[model samples]
Target: MKIFELPQTNPLSANRTIPNVDSRGFHYKDFETMKPEDSKLGDAGFYVGIKATCVYHSQTERIALHFLDFNTRVLTMRTHYPYYEEERFAKKYLSKAPIWRKEVATIDIDILYENDDFELAQHGVSCKDKEEEFLTQKVVRRSARDHEFYAGINGTWEPVVKNYFARKEYDNYEFILKHIRKSNVLALNEEALIVSQLWKKRGLKRPMDSLLEPFARKIGTDKHHLFRLTCVAIFLGHLRLDHKYEFNLRTPLRLRPDGVYQFSRGVETAPWGF
Candidate 1:
C-alpha cells in the first residue's frame, strides 16, 4: 500500500516558479503534479525507472537487464519491477493458489480486484482468509502466486519496499548486468529458439560448468558463446536457478519445476531496440 513520495504542493522556496502545465498536461497545485526531473537525488535514472516504468535510452542495443516472473514465466521490461528487494514487509501475507472465477463466488471472494481501464486483471490472493478471501491487496510479494507486485503506485516509493521475490527477480537481472558483457549478448546473439535445443525436457539438475564445453563442441560453437546463451536461457526460464545464489561456472540449474517450457514467452518482450 506504500506509494512513491512526490514533491509537496507548496515548495519551501519563495523565489521558485511553479508551472501551469505538467508533462501529463493541465494539472492541479498538488505535489502530485511533479516530474521526477525536479528531484534532488543524483540518481535520477534510479527513481525514473520506478515512477516512469522506463529509463531514457538505456544502453540495451548490446545488453539490457530483464526480469522474469518465476511463476508467470514471463519476462518484463528491465524497468518493470519493485525498487527494494527486501521481503520482510510481507508479514501480512498468506499462502494461496490461483482459483477459478466460477469457484470464487461460492468459495473464495477475498483475493480478486480490477484494473482502472478494466482491460487488465491482477490475480493475487493476499492478507485475508486462505479459503474465503484475499486479505491485503495494497501490497504483496511477487513470488506470491498470481500477485502483481507493481499493482497500483506501490512500487515508486522513496525508500523502496522490501520484497523477497522482487529481490530475487531483480537479483537475476543484476547478476546479468554486472557479469555478462554487452559484447557477450551481442556476439553470441543467442535467442530462445537456439537455447531450446539445449537440456530440453531433461529436467535434470546440473552444474552450469557441466554444459559449457560439451554443448560448445556438440554445436560447434565457442564455449563463451554457449555459456552466455545458457545465462539467457536461465533468465527466460528455459532453465531455472535458485537466484538467491550468485551465478558462477558451478551454478546449479534445472528445468523449471513445473516441467513446462516458457519457450520465449517472456524474453521476446524485453525491449532490445536494436
Candidate 2:
C-alpha cells in the first residue's frame, strides 16, 4: 500500500501567516486536529491545490489522483475512467501508469460538522443493522414486509435519511487529508474494494438493500453501486476496520509432500492471515 508523500516545500505556503486558514477564514488547526493541512502547509499556510496519483500495489493499480482544493474544501478526485476516450488514451499514452476514472466520488468536507445536530449522521455506520430489528417491531408484519422494512426502526425515514450512507463520504474526506499531509506518501486506496468484492462474491445482499437503498431512494442513486464506495470508508477507518496486518505469536507450520513440517508464509506473503 505505497502512497504518495507530500513534499516538504508546500505549494500552498508563500507569504502566509502562522495560523493558516482557508478562503472562508476558517483557521487551520494542528496536524492533530487538521491532520495533513498543518504538515503540508509548510510555508504557504494553506494549500491552494493538490494533484497526486493514487497508485496501489503496481502501476496498473493506478486508479485515480486526488485533486483537493483547500480554498473550497472540495476534493475533486479525477481519474481516467468511465469514458471510452479516457480508457483509450490511458492505454496508448499512460501505459506504465495506466488508470481508469469511470466513477468518481466528490466529497464535500463541510458536511462533517462536529455539532450535536449531526448526531444521527454519525450513526450512519449502524443503519443497516438497525433496519433489520425494525422489521419485527410488530407482530404478523409479514403482510407488509416491504412497507415495514422501509418504515425503519422508529417508524420514519428520518433516521435512515440522516444516517444514510454518509460515514464513508465523511471518512474519505478525512482520508485525503491524512494521506496528503506527507507530500511523498503514496495513499493506497485498497482494503475496502477487496472487502466489498468479497461480500459480493459471497452473494450477500443485505448491505445494499438496507444501508444504501435508503440513500439511493432519497437521492436517486444505485444502492449497490453506492455500497462499494461506503465499504471503502468502512474499511479505511480504524474504528470500523483494521486494514493493517500484524504478525502472529509464531509462524505456523505447513506440511510438505515428504511429510516434513515447514514454516508457512501467509498468502501474498503478508505478515498475518487466517
Candidate 3:
C-alpha cells in the first residue's frame, strides 16, 4: 500500500483553494467559481481533510491500498503576545521595537503504505489483514509548535516569549532583563501544576523531592533549583504548551540552554513533563 500526497486546502479562508490535483476529484480554480455549499466548507475552519483509494493489479495478483492523512496547525501568537512582552519588559528596556503580529500557515505531511500477492483464505479472510501486516500506515496530526520553523529553537514557550521581547525591546536592555526575572516566578507556578498532574497520573509520589529528582537528572542540573525554576517558567508561558522544548532525557543534554530542554528519541527521557 502506498500513500499518495493530497493537496492541502484552506477551508477556513473566504476564498476556497486547493493545492494540487490528480484523478480523485474536480479541482476548484478559485473560491468564486465554487457553489455556495462548497464554499461553506472554506469558511468552516476545517483546513485539513484526507482522501483514500485502492487499486489492484490483475496480472500480478497484487493488491494496493492508499491512505492519506491531512492535518493543520492554527497559530495564535497574538493571544500570548501581551504576556510575552510583559515578561520581556521590552517596551521599557529595549532600544529596538519588537514585532507583534499573528501568523498562519498550512503545513502538510504525506505518507504511503503497500502489500504484495497473498492468498486471501490463509490471510484472515480479509484484505485488511494483508494490508495491515504488509502496508505501512501514516497518521498526521497538528504540530504543537508553530514558530520553530521560523525561529532556530523548537518553539519552547519560554524562548518564544523571550525572543519576542528581545527583538522588540533590544534598546531597553535593563528593563528587559528585569522583566525576565519577574516572569520566571509566574512560569514556575504553572510548571508545578503541570508536573504534579504528570506525577499523579503515573502513580508516583507528588512530593517536591520526587518531582525534582527526575527533572534534575533529565536536564543535568541541580535537581531542586531546576525544578523550582521550571515550575516558574511553565506558569509564565515561558514553557508553552505548543512548544516542543522538553527536559527529562536519559542522557543529560541541553537542546536549548535558555529554553526548555527536550529529550530526543531512544534517550530514555522521563515523560513527566508532557
lDDT of each: 0.34, 0.27, 0.26
State every prediction's TM-score relative to the real structure.
0.39, 0.17, 0.17
Rate residue 169 of model 3 by lDDT.
17
- Over 1-274, each residue of candidate 1 has an lDDT whose tens digit, in order, gives 2111111121112122334442224231322222336323322243121001333122220012232122221112222222232242233233344333322111000111112332212222121212122234522322342223334423211112112123344545556544443433323334533664666743146776777777777778788767667665554334554443555667555444554422221232243222
Give residue 186's error in model 1 in angstroms: 11
Highest lDDT model number = 1
TM-score, candidate 1, is: 0.39
Query: What is the lDDT ranking, best to worst?
Result: 1, 2, 3
1 or 3: which has the higher TM-score? 1
Tell me the deviation in Å of residue 7 in model 3.
36
Q: Per-residue lDDT for 66-154 in model 2, tens only?
A: 11222111122222111123356656675675443422211112111112221211101111222444355451243243233223322
Q: Residues 207-250, candidate 3, lDDT per residue (tens digit)?
A: 44555677666546576555555434432324322123223323
Off by over 4 Å in 1: 1-37, 40-53, 56-160, 164-169, 178-191, 194-197, 200-206, 244-246, 260-274
Could you tell me which 10 consecutive residues in candidate 1 have the lowest summed lDDT?
A: 104-113
Q: Which residue runs of candidate 2 sit more than 4 Å off their true CA positions?
A: 1-211, 218-220, 235-239, 242-274
For every candidate, C-alpha RMSD to the true structure in Å: 18.8, 25.3, 24.1
lDDT of 2 at 105: 15
Consecutive 10-residue window with the lowest summed lDDT within model 2: 118-127
* Candidates 1 and 2 compared by lDDT, better number: 1
